[model samples]
Target: MTVQEFIEFKIISFGDYFVTPLHIMQMVILIIVSWTIILISKQVVQRQINSGRFDKGRGKALFQILNYSIIVLTIIAGLDMVGVKITLLLAGSAALLVGVGLGLQQVFNDIVSGILLLFEGTVTVGDIIELNNIVGKVEKISIRTSKIETRDGIVIIVPNSKLVSDNVINWSHNRSVTRFRIKVGVAYGSDVSLVMKLLSDSALEHPEVVRTPEPKARFIDFGESSLDFELLFYSKRMFDIEFVRSDIRVKIDQKFRENNITIPFPQRDLHFKTSDTFSIDKTK
Candidate 1:
């Protein structure tokens, strides 16, 4: 039943002061208003779920709005039922608002920032996000906070205000490609050109690595007894980035070994001198 109809039925049954015609009119209007709000909220939720246009951020905002609307409508309905004047409450609380404002500034900021984030399309649920050096996929966005699921399968709840104020990295925002640089050090005498070719072919052979960009092999620098070569390549966005990095290292080592590219070992040359007295006597 509509809120108005339900209230009318209750009033007739109760035989209270609300039984009067004026009271009946007010009750019916209040119920209708609340029902209208409920119906609209339902439609909004369904439409958002179907549309799939807004990212998780906007979707979450809409969901929160619907919840808040329903709550406000219920409050208004209850006040009307109990004969409390909302207008008077608004008037009497005018001075108190400033005091409450000072106390709840952070809360207000969170709510406002949550709304702004929804509209700005910064970080959305299902989008991989990196903020404050923590990498995770957004799981949920709420009024006061947001949830993120990291690769280690941990869930983190971060305040909404912090989300807006911090730098957010949306990994999957537009491009699903990620680049990683793997450094390989081979013996100084190793054929640098041959090493480059081997590394390139190894990267290309990997299914996850991109061939169009054509993994690049460049001489980075000279290390202690070895020459360092860097293999830069793009890969299909993998949730397990560390896995990709480790796998690339393993592949590079295997390839260098098979091709005889002399993966160098650290060596430091040392020259030892005789005691100072023996050296001085020999010089004399």
Candidate 2:
């Protein structure tokens, strides 16, 4: 046989569909072309991100959308090249898809949630979020899940649906800075004015604290053992807020010591009552 005839000779058949050397070559070429297109698209998206045309979170979402689109299109094209008609395949598997969909409802929900998160811009990569009392920074967002890195450097995989359905506090959303309060209690007899001044001064002394708004001290409540006070401050270090608070606390303690202010601990006095008949038992 001629080279052309050899290349075209069918090796296997499924119904009317035949697999041939020529067909295999065509499939290989199609895959290469699709991969090249995907790479080019990725490069363009990366350029946009690096150029500051889009913020990191938005850029990441866009890249994910583009990447998924390319993959889906590639799959469709690959099937078509292999002589499988997309419409016919879908029509034949319609019932099977329904059954699978029913079993994978949660999977579909996560995929939908991921799309919503990307489009709505509510939760995105690089955001500091609090969910179910777990506070972490979003590291990656995918079609079904997201990766969050906690303060201890532990990475947790969270379902996209959870992020969407649950109450999530996005600390870094729409603002670069957030307000945090540090609570401190001083002894009841301590000078209130001096305590307030010290709290304010300690916050101001911290480099991360914002200067414009100015930290203010509030006497929030009267406690049982000590006077409850809260120091409100704004800072840009959302992820490192715990450190900022600790530093301020240390400074506050040092200042209080210098000023002879005492932070009192909880104290309670217990009294014993003796009955008339039991009072004489002490002599025994």
Candidate 3:
């Protein structure tokens, strides 16, 4: 048989739709071309990202969108080449799709939310975020969920809908540095001026602390048994903030001890109204 006759030989048939060697070959070629386009697009996008011509998160998101679009178009073209009526097929599956959509409402919601996240750029990879009291750095964002690596190095997958519908704190969104405060109370009658100076100095001693904003010591209030003071400092380390705070606390403790500034414990005074009541308790 000639090559053209062999290529046109029908391999499968169903109603008006039929698959032939020619159709299969065409699909193979189409897929190869589509894959080449996707690869080239990825390379271009990565180059732009590397060159700082595009934001990494947004660029990746855009590339994924383009890749998926191309694949979908390729599928439609291949089906058409095989004599599959795209419009009729969709019409036939309309009822089934509705049923599936209803059953998978949350899944659909998450998928849509994922698309929103990628488009809006509100939440992205490498951002330090806090949700449901859990703080972590986003490692990946996909169509249905996101992966977050916590401060403890535990990775957690969070549904995209939750990120969109719930309140989230993005520490690295507006700026790199975030201000954190440590509250400490000194023993009553301890030199307030000395306490403030110590708090400021201890925070400044930390290398991670920002110097341009300058560490601040606020004499917040007078507690029942101590003088409350707050030490505020800015740092670029959001994920490791707990360690930074701990280091500052250690420094504050050492400084307070060296300066004889005591952190007083909670104190409560009791008054004895009658000795008779105490004697009754002893008898019982």
- Using all chains and alpha carbons, the TM-scores for the candidates as numbered come to 0.71, 0.89, 0.91
Output the TM-score of candidate 3: 0.91
Residue 137, candidate 1: Cα error in Å is: 1.2
**RMSD each, Å:** 6.3, 2.7, 3.0
* 10 residues in a row with least lDDT, candidate 2: 275-284
C-alpha lDDT of residue 60 in model 2: 83
- Per-residue error for 75 in candidate 2, Å, reads 0.8
lDDT winner, 1 or 3: 3
Q: CA lDDT of each candidate?
A: 0.76, 0.91, 0.90
Q: Give the per-residue lDDT digits (tens) of candidate 1, residues 148-239.
A: 88989999988888888888877777566767788878997898888888888778877788877788889999997889889888887556
RMSD of 3: 3.0
Q: Candidate 1: how many backbone clashes?
A: 1
Q: Candidate 1 — which pairs collide? A: 4-31
Q: How accurate is candidate 3 locally (lDDT)?
A: 0.90
Cα deviation at 257, candidate 2, in Å, is: 0.8
Writing each residue's lDDT as its tens digit, candidate 3 over 180-268 gives 99999988889888889999999999999999799999999978998999999999989989999999999999998898889888999
